[model samples]
Structure formats: structure tokens, C-alpha cells
Target chain A: MHFHVEVRNLCKDYPGKRALIDVSFGVERGEIFALIGPNGAGKTTLLRILDLLDEPSSGTVLFRGAEVDYSIKDRKDLRRGIGMVFQRTVLFNMSTFDNVAYGLKVRGMSEREIREGVKAALELVRLQGFEGRNALALSGGEAQRVALAQALAIEPELLLLDEPTANLDPRNASIIEEVLSRVNREGKTTIIMSTHNVFQAENLAHRIALLNEGKIERIGAFQDIFERPHRFLSEFARLENVFSGFSKATPEGTSIIDVGNGLHIEAAFERSGSVIVHIPPEDIILSTRPIVSSARNTLEGLVVQISDLGSIVKLKVRSNRDFTAQITKRSFNDMKIGLNSKVFLAFKASSVKMI
Target chain B: MESPFIEEVLSITLLSLRVSGLAVLIGALAGVPIGTILGFKRFRGKRTLMRLMDVALRSFVNTLMGLPPVVVGLVVYLLLSSSGPLGPLRLLYTPTAMILTQLIMVTPIIIGVTMSAVGGVEESIREKALSLGASNWQATWMVLREARMGLLTAIIVAFGAAISEVGGIMMAGGNIRWFTRTLTTAIVTEVELGNFALAISLGIILLTMAFAINLLLTIMQLRGVRG
Candidate 1:
């Protein structure tokens, strides 16, 4: 099958740092492909190279199975078929109408066409009645919408967004995501976006590439990748409570892992030798006193730190191993948990996954 | 208003306005493009060029900004003198000579201010424009639009400098009555003649003209800022 876009052996090197290292990917026409990674993972650099805004140190980007020519004339022609929205919205210091109309105007579209296209694009972004407002004076969300409208006005064949909702409120973020979905569905504009939000990648992208340290760690459908993650991905996905230990299968078909400092964690699965373990923060129950329960692993530790994360409180417990737990602020206040408070953390054998 | 003195003041004021206005107009027409090009374009060795300009070109322009009007007048005088290279034009001691001298005086000011103004626009604006499908020339035009307020200020400032100058016009124009006697030179002549009252009156009128021109330009700048 002919892919819409193909990136092969792409590498970007700066003076003192490597931003992308031998990155390769493909996007099918009409599919939403997401590049998911943390900050400084070179997501923006890769997106820029795809958008034809920057050149790679060594690589080839093929569109419709044809390698792209980096000449100025060819790049300009290619760029007209691609639209990019930056992480930081860049709107001209003009009215919203003019901002949206700029792309069409530069392409030398007729006045009537420009007017109709700009109006329709703005309507798609749900920013109607904002035509006369100065784009520079717009609120953050409104400015981002205006930028999206500007890109959509040209009706590009491919849409590239670099964290379009990175700084938006939840309402605006959802609105942008909805608009992106609708545009992909209705226009069949192949969409590629970079986002650090794992949930967002799962929600919107038909396929996702987990990127780390300028490399593509894994790329597949969300369910396939998340369900049976690679060792590195398991550690990346379960960001808070990962541990290295040795596991041995017991006679009862259960596994016991020596996770340093004489602490052994019991797991439902049977495994052997050294393994990495993941315990979800939400699964670990915190209590002031030890309780006799069905949970296989009950470790005693001291609350080294407590951080109030708005509605939830994150506690760092240091026992034989360091574990992070998220609890409700109300439960934290009721229990009166403070720094250096003694606590017991409990979880079932099934909760511990050996990667 | 019917007095000879009133007629003399009116003629001198009109002549001054005419010479300085033409000089500023021509200077702006020449300097704006040069400044814009210097401000926006980047090529290989651009940094080296800028470093050279920073150390040499800018210092030269700044030095010209404080150039004594009389020295410029003397240069124009020699150029337009009968025995000089440009003597065939016979422009010496004419209002044209005075205008040329003023033009030279203000062109550097306009160029310097305009260059700085265009430079003040964020580089990202141009990059964003290019990414949005604007061609090189189109992107530059957008930058120029963004720097319009500064450009207007440059014109106003050059106009002020042109109109208030005395030495260049005095040497080049010869202060001929009813032809080339501008406000500043006329005021000097009046003061030398011990006509203190008339000199003071001419000074007031000159100040009023400067105020009016600046006020108009400032209003334009404010409107640009608001938009």
C-alpha cells in the first residue's frame, strides 16, 4: 500500500546535541498519527522536518511514495499542501478575519474565495463573530483557534499540529480535539500531531509512536502497545512506581521477587531471574496501621513527602523501596498524614506486573 | 500683516518649509529601502557583515548624526562651486543646493532609524509568515508593515533634523532673501542685525511648525499602535 507520508532514517544534529536519531515512520492517508513523548524528546523538531519548515541532517521524506525535492520552488509547492500549527500560536497583528485570510491571500486567491474560505474555517473552529477582533488581543484559547482557522483556510492535504492544546483550558482542548477529528473525518486531511499527554494520544490517534531520547521506542495501535508494552515502555508508562528485582516461581504457581533491602514482592504471574516490576500508584492502598488483608504485598514505610496536587495528594513513601501513591486530599486530611509519618502500603499480587 | 517685515517673515518661512519638506521626502524615498534590506536579509557571512557594520557602518552613521551642518555645507559648496567637479550644474548658492545639503544631512538619520525599527520586529514573525506560505518578498512586506510606526517616526525625526539645521543651508543657500533664507538662517541674520523682537517672533513660528508636524506624526504612530 502506498503511504501518504514516509520518513526514513531521519537524523537531526545540532552543534552540541542530537535532536533526532535515525527516526523512521509512515502515515497512511486519512489516519491520525501521533508522536507521543515527554519534553525535550525532539517531537517539535521532527514535526518541523515533516512540515518542510526545516531540513534534516540526513534522511528522506517521501510523499505518495515520491521523494520530496528540497529546492525552494518544490518546497513552496509542497508546503501549500501541508498546514502546520505551532505549539505557540503565531498570529499576525491583524484582525481575526485578516489572520485567517492571510494564507489564501498569499496564494493569490480571489477576494470572494478568500472571504468564503476564511468564514468557513472560522466557523469550523467555532470562532464565528470574531472576524473583526484583533488577533493579537485574543485570549490564549481564542488565539489558538484563530491559528487553526488560518491553517484550515488553505484546506491542506496534510495537517501537522505541535501540541495544539498544550496550554489551553480543558474546554478549549476538547474543542480543538473535536475539531481535529471532524476535519480528519470530513476532509480526509491526514493528521499528524505531537503531544506529551499519553491519554490524548490514546484518545485521538489511530496509531501512536512512543518517543524517548530522540528515538522511537515503539509504534503501534494504542491498545496493542499499551497492553503488551516493551520493557522501556512499561517503565515509561507506569511513570511513578517501577522497581528492579529478581523473580522466582514458587511451588504454588505464584512468583516472588526480591526487590532489594530484603523486601520480597509477591506477584500472581510466574517468572524467573531478574525482572522489572510496575505497581500502579492508584492500586497501592495507604494506611497508618498494618491490616490483615488478602493483599499479598504489605510493605511498611515512612511518608517522606506529601504534595497536594489540587484534588489529589501525592505521597512519597520510602521503605525498602520508594513508592509513589496518589490519594484523595480529603483522605489525606482525615488521616492527618505528614512528613516522616509511618505508613503501610498494601496491594494484591495481581497488581504487580513483571516486565 | 501689511508690513514689509511681515512679508519678509512669510517668505522666509515658506522657503524654509519648501526646502526642508523636499529634502525629507527625497531622503525617505531613498533611505527606507536601503534600511529595510539591511534589516531583514540574511546570507552567508551575514554575521561577519553585521559585525563589520556594527563596528564601522553604524559608527559612521552615528557620527554623521552629529555632523556639523557647516561642514556638510562646505562640502556641498565645493561640489557646486564653479571650479569644482559638479560646477557644470551651476547649482551653487541656489535653493536647490540648500535642499541637497539638507537631504544629505537627514538621509543617514532616516536610514539608521528605519534599520533599527525593522530590526526590532521579532524574527519569528518572518519565519511564521514563511511557514504559512508567504514568499520571501511577501514575508518582508509583512515585516515592513509591522515596523510602520518606527518608519514613520524615522521620517518625522529626519524632518525635524532637516528643518532645524542652519549651517549647511547658510553656506549652500547664501541666505538670499525671498529665495533661500530659511527660518534658522533668517533668525540668525535677524539676531546679527540686532532685531531681537523679529528674531524672537521667527523662533516662535519655527517652534510652532515643529510642534504641528510632530503632533501629526505622533497621532499617526498612536493609531498604528492601537491597531
Candidate 2:
């Protein structure tokens, strides 16, 4: 398999801390890859390093099998094939057409080619008629599209996007995502983006790299990462029903006591000491009272926080052992769950994927 | 009492224009690079240099701004009056002396204002320019282009300051009638000679010049905002 972009043991250090530590990953051609992390997780730093805006302290990045050159003289040829959209969209206070055409102009494209290319790029971003408008006056989403158009006008083989949807409303965010998806589909560009929105990653990324504390804890297919995540990865992914407790033996063979509670939960692990449980938020069923069921695990907890992650409402249920569950907004509304509400959170034996 | 001599009023008015205008031109040529350097470069003693230039230039400007035209004239007179070193150049009592005096007076204002204008080009914008494949010189050019209107306004303000002041002209130019007497000096000489109509006409012309320069600056400020 030909990898369009390859990173080998990339490391970056700032004044007092390591921003990126030995991060290595590769993106196959025409794949959508994600670099997901929190604020200081070095997501943008890695993207910048790959884009050649910044240099790594050590290690190498290869584009299309060639070693990455950090020098401008050597990298200009490489840079010509890579386009980057910054976290904060920047467009010269000129017309959208000029903004999109600038890269082409700088690269010494003929005027006719620039015109055709810019038009096509703007059309791809669904900003066809806005060519005459001042780029500065465009809305957040529109401006982002203009930024994308500028990069697209160059027709780069690799596209690096840094938190492209962080600041937009959901509608605008979706618009950008759709535009990107179309671009990736049509141009077969090897696209890597950093996102705060987990759902956007789920929707767009062929493979997701979960970055935490400047380390790549997990990188896999989106479904694989979501379904069977590493312990820290599950937490970072904010998977529902992640709880840990000690295992104890009973007449039922083996069980675990969720420390905060006196009750025992069935154990799937034979050699369990301190074990962690990952129950998808959607898997947890909320009820007003005790129910007799073969589902095996039932924990009592108080609703601590309800966050609206677009389609899903994340219920932070704090039990004797802290547990989190992902529930639909409809489910949350049906339950009328509010902060400090006493609730019973239940999930089936098969639903709890222990890692 | 009857009105004083008209020629002195004309001469003083003429002297202010000639000296200050010449000073502004020279100051701008000198200050633009200094301001650009101070705004863009970060060295070990940059803050120190900035502070030193700030205190020194501001005090120098204020001193020159406050100095009486006769004192500047007397100083120029003393410097070129044969006894002084290199007085043989005979620069004293010449329009060039007046021009030199005003030029020194206005240099600081031009430097200070132009520095601020260049400084206003945001660092983020600078980085953005660099990321967009701009060379260091290209990035500097972008900053300077974006800050062009502000720089122009600084120049205009410097020009206005240079053209209306009277101190350097009377002392350095010696307010020679019909020859070295610019508007400011001419007005002074005319007022002293009780040439009220001529002095007032020259006053009107000086005020108009100042107004025109200020208007041009205001337009530039607006253009800076629009651009």
C-alpha cells in the first residue's frame, strides 16, 4: 500500500515541555485522517510540522516517499504540493476571487488558468457567486470556505487542516465538513485534520489518531477506535459507561464491587485485580427504579452534568465509582434528567467492553 | 500706539515656514528607516534602544518645540559667526541654517509616529504572511504596505509641524526681506512693520497651508481605515 504521507518518530520540544513526542502515523492516499486531542495535546504543532511551517526537534516526515526537507530552499517544491488551512482563517482583505487566486498567482500560474482554477475551487466550496465579495465580510463558515478554496486552488496533494470547525455553529460546521468531504472524495487529496468535535471525526475520518499528553495513545479505524478503545483512549473519546472496580469471587464465580457502592457487578475477566469497564454511553439504560433483568450490571448514580454534543447528550453520571453514559437527547428529555437527580444506570453484560 | 514694523512680521512668518518645512523633509528621510528597524527587529537591547530613543527624542522635540525662534537664530548665528568652529562655511544667516534647525526639531515626531504605525501591524499577520510563503523581505513589505496610510499620516503631521513654526526661521534665515522670508517669517516681519494687511494675508496663507496639510492627513487616516 502506498502511503501518501508518513511520519517517523517525530518529536518537538518547546521551552519547558515536549509538545509532540515521537508521533508516527501514515495516511494512505484518499483517506481522511484525524488528529484529535485537547488544547495542549500538540495537535496543531504536529500539523504545522508536517506542513513545514515549523520544524521538529528530531525525526522525519516523508511526503510521497521523499524525506521531508525543513529548509525553504529545499521544501518549496514539497510545499507546492501541500496546502494547509489554518485554525484561524486568514484572507487578505480583498475579494474572495483574489483570495483564492493568490496562491496560484504566487506560484506563477497563468492568468487564464488562475481564473479557471479559482472558479472551480470556489464552486467546490459552494462559494461560486461570492468571488466579487470582500473576503473579510464573509461569515465564519464562508470565510473558512474561502480559506479552503485558496488551498484548493493550488490543487495540493496533501491538505492539512487545524481545527477547521472549532469556532463555527453546528450548521456552519456541517457545511464545512460537507465541503471537505466533497473535496476529499473528488480530488483524492490525503487529508489530515485536527478536530475538537468528536462526531465530526466519526463522520469524516477513515482512521482516527487519538493524541493525549503529546503521545499517540491509539490510532485505528474510526469504528475500531470507538468500539474497542484503550483505557485512556476511551476516556479521551468520552465513551459512555467507563467505570472501574475491584474483582471479588462469589458463588457466581467472580464479580467486581464498584468501590463506591457495596453491590457486586459480574466480572468478564478471570484474572482481575483493579479492572476498568467501558460501557458505551448509548448502551446505558436509565430507569427510575430497580428492574429485574439478566443484563448483569446496574449502578446507582446521581446526574452530575448533561452536555449537548449535537445529536447526543452526554450524561456524566457520578456513581460510588464514576460512570459516564451517552444517551440520546430524546432519551434525556424523556427521562427529564436534571442535575443532582438520583438515577439508576444499567447496561448489559455484553455491552460493557472491558479493556 | 501705532502698529509696529510690517517687515519683521513677514520675516518671522517666512522664517518659520522655511526652517520647519526643511526640517520635516530631512527628518522623514532619516526617521523612516529608524522607525522601521525599531518596529521590526528584536535584539538584546531593543527595548533599551527604544526607551533611549523615546526619552531622548521626545525631550529633544519638546525642547526644540518650546525654544524661541530668536534663541535658535541666535544659536545658529553664534555657530556660524566666524568665531565658531567652521564658521567659514558661512551657513549662518542662510535659509539652509533655518532649514537645518527645523529639520532637527521635527525628526523626533516623525520617528515616533512612524514607529507606532509599523508596530501596529499585528504579529499574527506577520506570521500569516510568513506561512504563506513570503520571504522575510516580502513579509516586511507586506507589513509596510498595510501600514502605508499610517506612515503617510505621520509624514503629513510632521510636515504640518514643520511648516507653521517660526522659531528657527528668524534666527537661522536672518529673515532677509523678499529673499529668505517664507510665509511665517514674512508675516512676522510685516506685523513688526505695521503692514497689517500684508501680515494678515501671510497669516491667512500660513493657516491655509497648515489646514491643507491637516486635511490631507485626515484623508490618509480615513484611507488607512478603509484599506
Candidate 3:
């Protein structure tokens, strides 16, 4: 009943900063485990520690019930069982075929065996027939795929990814996600990936670890964690308009939470006492003036900041508290809103999520 | 074309290539691995003793890379002098002595340049290789492969220094006609002896040979890039 890999009280210290703090976790065999967090959360450090590339400042890392021996001279067999894809795609200055064949070749596989392995790996990443192309000459997506193919060519038992899809285009990102799912299901490889993308974790990982400020804040499935409102998670998960407030259940089975600054937020939940909530930026409607509506909350504010994102515009409105409202650029132009314009932010009670 | 001056020029040109080519080849054999090791040494987690050793070794190599030709000539002359340690071999005033002098001059150039080349690609390629199940030696080799063009440039640079040098070969080789004399040494003599025509001709031949060698190596480097 040993976990595939388990870290107990792992810590890593740089000269002036502690990268990881007394972190502990375990992943089951063949499980798609994710370490999700914002930047500087020590996800990369944890992966490097698990990969044996970096020793933890202090702790025990058990791989398949065996404590990793970093001092050992010959750990190729152990290392061959684990593969890591770094956040930066660093392919060798060679043909794609040679880049992918590197692992198999180093393992002393026959040329034919290497060819087959490279072909299979390239096919898995949908980069087949990319053998003769220079890896460095490829586009970012193609190069990342080559990096993936290189790791997959070895077919390791465990795969560690450090933000594999952090900056990829959606099309390439989905392709990598699909490949990871297939590799986990078909190859039976235990996959531990670090990402800040919540939807990706929900879509692929069996469980997620919310890492923050050099420590693992929480670890659970999305459903398991949905009950608890974590401000840290809400912040790093990039959700905006989060407010902590005291709630009282209304007679209508809903609740009204009185946040600070005399702003009371109505939520579609029965939570009492203190709770955290995030209103979707898109859910808030912005108007030139205060207007009456069926929406539960409407705060009058001035547009403090405007971020034009081509199709959509995000305006930070300051009333009693700051609220970010997302609106289509067309809507923004139609309203002729400018800085210091008095605006009304409106959203329904159901739009304020508990976590 | 029927003049015996052509033969003289040919002999000096051939002698220059033989001495410099052999020196560069032997220097690469001895220098590349050392440079690779020096270039890829990591500073983290190493003991103070090891760190000191790395610093000492690097300083030694850096000093050697800038050793002047005349200084190298004097050192090799002392080493191979009659009263010196290697005096028993009687290598003075021979092509072998010239080769040895050039070898000493170029080995550090090769080592220093190669160290830089390997350093450029070391971190990323080494990490990538090890993550791909490469052993320490295998990872080192992968980094070296990635730095191959740099290594080639090192050889070309080393060869240029060796073939163009007149001081070291002149001192160590004594510039003996038809035996130890190279294009560079012969040109020096031709210019000093007031044979401007002969000196200019030898200079052209020397420049041509160097251009051809560099062209060949550069083509190889470009092919590597294309790959």
C-alpha cells in the first residue's frame, strides 16, 4: 500500500529565501496528481527534489517505498524510471529525431529500438515526421512538443512537469493536456504536474495540491475543497473581487454577508459567521449611472483603471471597495466611459461563489 | 613557375601546415576534455577546498592562454636546451621543437576558447540530458556535442595563432632552411635579408593556406548549424 511517491516535510532553502517550507504530499501509482499554485510557490523546487536533480534542504522522499539516494554514483536505473519536463523547453541543437532519441540512446537501446521509441513518442505528441527538422528552429509549440517527445521516448514510470502548459497557445496546450491524459491512462505513468491553471487540474488531475508561499496550503479534489473558502486559493487561482465577511442566513434560504466598508454582499448560500467569496468579473454589469434591477447588489463607483484587452475591457471601479468589472470593449465604447466616470456595478447574489 | 623559389615557398608552406596542424590536433586531444570540465563546474554545494581548486585551475589556464609567443619560445628553449631537463633528446633547432613550441602556445588558446564554448551550452543541455536518463559522462558528452561548433572555432583560432607566430618557432626552431623553417619564419628571414619579392610571395601562400583551412572548418560548423 505504498504510495508511488511520497515526500515528508520537504524543505528547500536558497541563500536569501526559503523556496519550500515543511511540505508533505503523496501520489498514488498511475494517478494524475497536480501541484497548482501561483508563482514563487515552490512547485518547481518540489519537482526538482522529486526528480533528484536538487536535494531538499531537509526531508525524506520515498519513491515506490525506497528512499531516494542522491549521493549514489550509479542511479541511472532509478533516474530512467522518472522523467521531468522543465518549464522552459530546452531541446538539444540537433534534429528532432536526435533530440527524442537522446534518452533511449543513452540507455543503450539499439538504433532500431531508439527509432521506434522516437517515432512512437513523436506520434503521441502529434509531431510525427518531424525527424529531420532542427529542434531549435521550430516554433515555440513545436519545440515544446519536441521536448515532450524527448521525455516520452524513454517511457518512464513517473513524469514530473513544471508548468508544462504555462505559456502555450490554447491549441497546443490542449494537445499537451490530451497527451498527458493518454499517457496517464494508457501508459500507466504516475504524473505529477505543477500548474496554476485550475481548469486544467480539474480536467486532468485526480487530485490537486494548492501550494502557496513556499508551503502546501491544501490538497484535495475540487469537490473536496469546494466546501472550504481559502483566501489564498482564491487569490492565486486568479479570482478577483474576493471579500471576507460575516454572513447571516436569510429566511428565504439565501444569505447576506456584510463585508467591510458598509458593503453587504448577498450570496446564494446559507453560510453564517465568516466566509470568503469571489464575484466573477464578467458577471458584474457596468452602467453610466445607478439603475434599479433584480440583481442583489449595485454599488456606485468611479472607474479608477481601464485595461483594454482587445475584445474585452476590465475596469477597476472604486466605491466603498474596489471591484473589477469585465465588459466587452464595444459596450465600454457605447457607454463612452473614461477615467473618473461614475459607474454602477451590478451582479446577482448567485454570482458570488463561496470559494 | 620554373624558379626554385617556388620549391622554397612550397617547402615553407608545407612545413608550416605540418607543424601547426600537428600542434593543433595534439592540443585538442589534451585540451578539450580539460576545458569541458572547467567550463561546466558548478559552484553550488561544493566544498571550499574544491572551490579553491577550481579557482586555482581556472586562473592557471587563463594565465596560460595569454602567454606571449616570445615567452613561450623562451620557456620551450629552456626546457629543450642542452643543460635543461629535456636536453638529452636534442630536439632544439628541429621541426619537432617548432611543433612543441606551437603546441604549448596553442593548447591554452584551445582550452580557453573551448571552455567558453562549453560554458555557453552547459547548463541547459546538461540538465536536459540528465533528465533524459543520461549518466554524468553521457550528459557531459551531450553538452560537448552541442558546443561542437565552439570547439571547431577553438581549433581554427589555435591553428591561426600557431601558423602566424614567428617568435616561438624562430627561437625554438632556429629557422633552419629546408628543415625547421616554416612560412612565417622564412618570411621573417626573407624580409630581414632584403628579399621583398620572396617575402611577399611566402606571405600570400601563408594567407591562402590559412584561408583554406578556416573555410573548410567554417563549412563544417555551418553544416552543424544546419543540423
DockQ of each: 0.50, 0.24, 0.68
TM-score of chain B of each: 0.93, 0.76, 0.93
RMSD of each: 5.6, 6.1, 5.6
lDDT of 2 by residue, B87-130 (tens): 99988777787777676666766766777788776665555555
Which ranking of candidates, highest lDDT first?
Answer: 3, 1, 2
Q: Which candidate, 1 or 3, would have the higher lDDT against the true structure?
A: 3
| Model 3 docking tier (incorrect/acceptable/medium/high) | medium
Summed backbone clashes in each candidate are 0, 48, 0
lDDT score, candidate 2, position A165: 82
lDDT of 2 by residue, A1-355 (tens): 5578999999999878999999999899999999888788999999888878689999999888878878654345557778888999877756889778877876778999999999999988788899888888889889988888888888888888999988776566766787788889987988999987677788789999999889998898878877766777656655545567776645655455454456556655454577776666677787767756777888788988766654666767787666767777687788888999888878776675667
Q: List candidate 2 stretches off by more than 4 Å.
A: A1-3, A71-78, A234-277, A281-349, B1-30, B41-99, B190-201
Which DockQ-derived CAPRI band holds candidate 1?
medium
Most accurate candidate by lDDT: 3
**Which regions of candidate 1 deviate over 4 angstroms?**
A73-75, A228-348, B3-7, B41-55
Put down candidate 3 lDDT per residue, A1-355, tens digits, no spaces: 9999999998899988999999998899999999988898899989988887888889889999989887776567779799889899999988999999999999999989998999999999999889999898998888888888888999989999999987787568778888999999999999999987666776789998988889988899966764454777787776558888899999988999988899898888897888888887778988997779999888999999876543567788999889989888799999999999999989999898886
Give me the candidate number with maximum TM-score.
3
TM-score of chain B as predicted in candidate 1:
0.93
Tens digits of lDDT, candidate 1, A263-318: 89999999889988888777899999996899999989999976554446778999
